[model samples]
Target: MNGGDVTEEAGEPVPESLWLATTSSTEYEPLPGDRRVDTAIVGGGIVGLTAAIRLKEAGHEVAVIETGRVVEGVTGHTTAKLTSQHGLRYDRLCSTFGREYARQYATANEAAIDAVERRVEEDGIECDFRRTEAYVYTESRSDGSDLLDETRAARRLGLPASYTETTPLPFDVEGAIRFDEQAEFHPRKYLLALAAAVDGDGSSVFETTRALDIDPGRQPRVTTDRGVVVADQVIVASHFPFFDRGGYFARVHPKRAYLLAVRISGEPPEGMFYSTATPPATIRGAPVDGERLLIVGGQGHEPGLDGPATSERYRRCEAFARERFEVESVEYRWSTHDLSPVDGVPFVGRLGPTTRNVYVGTGFDGWGMTGGIAAGTILADLIVNGSSPWADVFDPNRFTPAASAKALVEDNALVAARFLGDRIRTALAGSGTLPSPGEGTVVRQGGKPVAVSRGEDGELHAVSAVCPHMWCLVEWNDAERTWDCPCHGSRFDPDGTVRSGPALEDLTDRSG
Candidate 1:
């Protein structure tokens, strides 16, 4: 999945995120001990770091605790398009929410673009931030009609959108909705600068410190593996909220998407392009030491992958790239998961009814760059000014109609079925032990299902197959060599340490 799958193989492994592989790594030490700050942020992604800098500027001491390196999670693995046009989303927002609500959504995201530019200029972050246009196009004539509708709706909402019949792609598109003044950047480089701004100045950034739970109040206490952070407020920016008293698990569910960065013969497309046709693909380019790399992304599916095999996802995107562009070698490939909100809008305010000082910014769907930065502004404003004009649309307590609510329920049903049904199936034929090499599966050992895998070095490793999040039977992801929980998207490394969480505890080791 997006954030959890982080282990490099012994040799000849699929490359990790191009952003992480190319950028300079950070050096924030883990939380040393008890810390007292004005706010304690739980994740080190774009949303958390953005909020941290904003809070520190408002004279608030903030401490950001991360389970691993900052920006190396979901934020690093993204396509990195910093645009407000999220695949014809404005039309749906107007229909589901209304014109006014859609306007607020557009305003927050469009303003976030300017905010990022201002920070890059003021802080002098060399993140390859560039101005570009973003387009969502279709290859089919019928889908082009939908593009026209989106163009009109976006114009009504004051977005810089236009309908066009042409683009910079090598192939022809029936039509497209183009948004002007949108931008793309090196997300890790940009966030590292913000991370630097948050640290020092009496504020701190603590990496490799996992927050187990939060005791919320006016002076909220964040209990991490290292120590406790007592702060005036707690911000739950963790991609999947570890503490789920707000029932965020139900409201936001994870969907995994794959990306491949490949070298092309000629200069890549100059603008951000997303094809909304069959086998949807998002194409962009990144500068790597003067040569440009074409980024082909977007084959989103539920984490359980109840559909096609996971290995097929990477091939599909690569096929799309090779079909339209000049052939070269695929450089890097990785996958990521995002928590999509049942309602279109993300939750970006008070976390729950009882916890007033505890805040959250989650469920950006698959478009986090702008939504995440906008969350920082809304969250910071709520902490500093008591309210924000855009808070109503993203409030955690908004009403959910039964119709819109069914998507989440259906997603959960699949997860539940996978959990329960897999366990029963494993019980029927659980005699298999370890796979040959670079493979894993669940097998019966000592009356329990054990996740067994053999490394390329002929070494054996084993861990309990049960997931700690809700006792679901974990499935082996051969592509990542990790165990993924279908129930809630928590993932674990081969040796059983959590790579991602909703489950703070590791799997019970059975290797010995």
Candidate 2:
């Protein structure tokens, strides 16, 4: 599609989240030369900032290193449902890892909600924080049994779960797993406050400072673009651990999803709604100018696996919204990717086996809203008190063959296939036409793969197609106007700068 076509379809020149556009951003400079702190947290998203705040409460000096603005990473682009009901998770967790694991998972997330509430109340943070019921509903009768099972599992795990056929939705649902006293919030507003709290008082928040590597030892050193941050401990919370010593790239798979904020003709549903359908749809209302605007999200797929179809996810979400609600206009559109663990749980705590003073949190499985905050307390407990009740539950070193073996094997196999298979097709697809405005593609240049694109203004740009993270061929994400590495979900701007996802470094500039 051309630039005009993309604008007409996606409602903007580039996809922007509703939270980002509505909030004011920070002006913190990059790491000013070498720094020293008690703890240096990498990545300025929810997990890093939350952990930084908790450590500060324990009187620890901290510094945060961010590739971009704080809270503008995965934490800024979430569905923002703060609940223990993680999309029918307990049933699968119980079946896979047993009730004990499920209970701890439930407890951490439930307490995550309370943690956010307590912080908001204590700090007087006006982040549009409000309690709402969270639902995982199914529209198909055939899915009711599974939904009922999930409800039973959640309730048994002490989540306030209720099974219901009727809902406050505009359309009908066969059944749903409902949890009471859950919440929806302006995540950026809340975390921005935490970021502010994390700054000053011998603590620091550094933006535009990307952590390139971590040297974990007596004093863990986080090497960054500007300088190094030497600290007593370190936390890698950059969504997809930029430094993957734990082989997280294998245990966790990448899934890309789209989101759109639209104004409806009438009132939206008064709670968070997630459907249990394939590629599961999510609906939640946000306050907009004294009224409410419905945010429709879904149409998920593995990165690079879908090829040219990646751009069509936004259209799919638009169609879903129009078919159900009276979408007056799609006000905002954005896309975000999450790391899904092969197992049901997230990997938190130590960065790897036999590692000390280095912690990592990733594989949130698209529930970073709660998981990120929970990870903060978990990491804080591990750092200050040496252990937490959730230590073993989310231990990065803890591996269960039954829970993770199949997925771990499948994920790596797909990666290996892509690494080989993409190259196999590259030579044939090279010499194709230069991408139209707002589009990009990988082509053969001098017998090597080159990622090339044209801007909205018709200016051409090029970069080496190989991803710095794992050497997987990069693919064009037309909707987001970025090059996405299918293997690790590392995204880069048209100019080759790392936009988000893994890959701590940018794509190689291929200027002639």
Candidate 3:
């Protein structure tokens, strides 16, 4: 669902990302009955769109089926930083995998940035792309050594990295690593331009078309709500793969983070700054309606974490922004979900070991802008040439058991605990009470958990709380007014329609 369509119980508009609010919406018709294409892309975010463009350019017929509007998914909700400076990544990558693999990761991301810039220039896409330095700094004395080590690791790999004592942030810092020639842009605008380019030459982009299943065969078929897209290859770029035959749920952990765009009283930051401190903060500037606003983000936690409510996350971000910068007004606030792989590297190749034709790209770990583009390029090459030089690094089927074993166990354990714990708690709690307007809760009804939410109009809406993806109890996201799965990050509208997936089906309505 679009941000403009979501509202709170008081009938006040829920805060939207500055990107979504500022950009004009574009509409595309859903897939008309059954269709056939050489490739079927299941998502319309940056990854899917870029893959569509690349595949179509390679002379393959492509179709993009999006459950919602193109580019309005996680891509539209991102900080839109096109840098490879994911927090403390290089050091870990070097230690875990090796220096060469880390270098390849860095190279892939650097190439992704260049690819985006090259496309914008060649296509004349007016997406307000701008080049700026990226900084990862720390205020803590303990993190200083980490920052320096990261700089060393990055620079040794030929990345444009240097350790510095200063940053564009208004506050002081102990140390920071600066990566030059990084960039940022309006992601929706760029994707829209690409979507337009993909809408011809026997290729098409479809909105509001949900992919239900993928049938593996010599020629894969993607089953959807309206029809099936029979294609020689399928790419599951839908943030979380809809068809989880490869058991991606066990490999990826989803974290939710908040963002706030505020008008600062003084000059905005000149560069992108990300802090390595606790409760990490990322600061960047966005030109909006002739004035540059400071976008402050980062207060991440797994969904359904017991401590703070969803609104509290935004409030924390707002507080950080106002305290650090002389904020004038908070223009926008939003949250985005990121999928982090057990290992630092993203999974961007064939969906499974034997499933050569079906591909997937995920586990961006909050660096989707670059990761997604890199995935697009890699997937495009794999689909066309049947191989990519980067395939060994990003192979979705490759198992680094020693490195990822602990994470895989821990993440799945948390999921199992949440799943069983929520069910028991709700069973003991029992249902019957109706929450007030703008409130939601899970309670037992006839020995089953029911999700009950009251809207602004005082209408009670109820649905089964179990997520169709993996039977994890869906938690109420008051900020977004949706049921969010804690296990795999599937989200559904209050009325139970699927908003994001891995869960292709709607929550069963049990209000009656």
Candidate 4:
């Protein structure tokens, strides 16, 4: 198997649990008849629901239109560690940007965590919210001096953080950084309660209602396949925003990370843990009725590149977990896609200076728990009050010299590499089917390039391989079962219907 194929190999298979099991939660029912709102939130995830709740409390008529059930997107698969400690980010941010910018980021995240706690208490949500220490360690072979530097920076910013060496890990470490009073919890449970609250007076969440198109005029109008939502403001919180304002697709990169939920027969680790070293490993667990459920996460890659190696990543994590705790069975296996910003901080305000009514909050870089909440607050404040101090820091319009330059070079390079690779494969195949069964690519045949896939039933399905977005080549993402564009981050189903996009057109299934 190629290096990409090894990602799917699981060392110890875990029995599946129904926790966050995703089904067709998209609301396909007809949109609400002739309804208008003060704000229309286009996503039902943490950012959207949180914005809806806040807007309602502000006495504004709010409506949330979701393509699927609330929280079923990236939020459901999060590590659920509510910590401001995002790897070794602070030191890098303070150095590359400025101490002031770094402090703003730290403060925003800390405030977000406090907001979550206050919301939990106010709503009386039974989401198992608990204060725990969060640690980022490195293996003996790796250097985590950056983490120590960040801990110091965090302390300087008045965050409850410090440096440490001791950990409950199985192996020895160089050093570890710890943030005290950080948290962990059941994200879906908390979000479900938030959804319920948002469904109250002045706010309503409509699931299965996908916003097909959005126009940012004096008043924003979101057009779904069935109907339309007319509102004064719009928030694009759909993981990766459907619209590509400020060139977000190029300003950030998309990564797919895997997770394994293992139920161990032994005692649990004391605190939440992660590693800064390459091929990162994150471990966190909680005791449910005396049984410890260890959630192991890591093995991030550029979405479709490591499809074959999916299982091996999980196996390596399972072995690491087994060494420390008696792992019983792997209870859940899933993955999530997150956008990593060029700089460490997320883009959390207006889409761009030109688009006044259009706002966005994305590029969390795997710190979704805290970042999502912060995004909601910043985006909502911009929409309602027209001014926020935090908006200037995260404004998509403010150009980052280092970040934007790095993003342009890095993201474009990946797309070019994939394009050339596809061309080489096509030339080698010549005039025949290149039966690379598990791979998805464009092969030249019958004087045309075709998208070919070997179905599970041993059948060949071929269609036009050209992406509906800018005619880029499409790569098959085995983990998410979708065809993804490497260039601009649009995704499509096997028979495409705009699964995700900057492209509005769906893939026409030519599998005849």
Worst 10 residues of 3 by lDDT: 1-10
Worst 10 residues of 1 by lDDT: 1-10
Which candidate has the top score in lDDT?
A: 3
Preferred candidate (TM-score higher): 2 or 4:
2
TM per candidate comes to: 0.95, 0.96, 0.96, 0.89
User: What is the C-alpha lDDT profile of model 3 across 79-164, one tens digit per residue?
Assistant: 99999888888888888878777888899999989998999999999887999999998878888888888999999888999999
Candidate 4 residue-wise lDDT, 15-88, digit = tens: 33224752223332445655688998988888888888888888888888887577877887788889988887
Q: Which parts of model 4 have CA positions greater than 4 angstroms off? A: 1-19, 22-30, 141-144, 287-290, 304-308, 427-442, 479-481, 488-491, 497-505
Runs in model 1 with CA error above 4 Å? Answer: 1-14
- In model 2, the runs with Cα more than 4 Å from the true position are 1-14
lDDT of 1 by residue, 1-512 (tens): 11222122212324699889888889899998998988999999989998999999999999999998999889989999999999878888888888898899999999999999998898888999999999998888988778988999999999999999999999998999899999999999899988988999789999999999899866889999899999989999988878887888778877788888888899998899987865468899999888999998777877664565566666666666667777477888888888888787898998999998899999998889999999988999999999888988898888857325677678667767777687786788556455888888888888888888778888888899998887888887777778888766889998999898878889999877
* lDDT (10s digit) by residue, model 2, range 1-512: 11112223434423689899889889998899998899999989989999999999999999989888998887788888898887878888988888998889999999999999998898899989999999889877898888878888888888899988888999877888779999999999999999999999899999988888888777789999899889999999888888878988788888888889988898898899988788899899998668788998898778766343655777778778877877778888888888888886899999987568899988899998899998988999899999899777899998788888888888888888878878887978856699899988889989989999999999999999999888899988877788888887888899999887578678888878
* Ranking, TM-score, top scorer first: 2, 3, 1, 4
Q: Is candidate 3 or candidate 4 better by TM-score?
A: 3
Q: Whole-model Cα lDDT per candidate?
A: 0.85, 0.86, 0.87, 0.74
- For candidate 2, list the clashing residue pairs, or say none: none
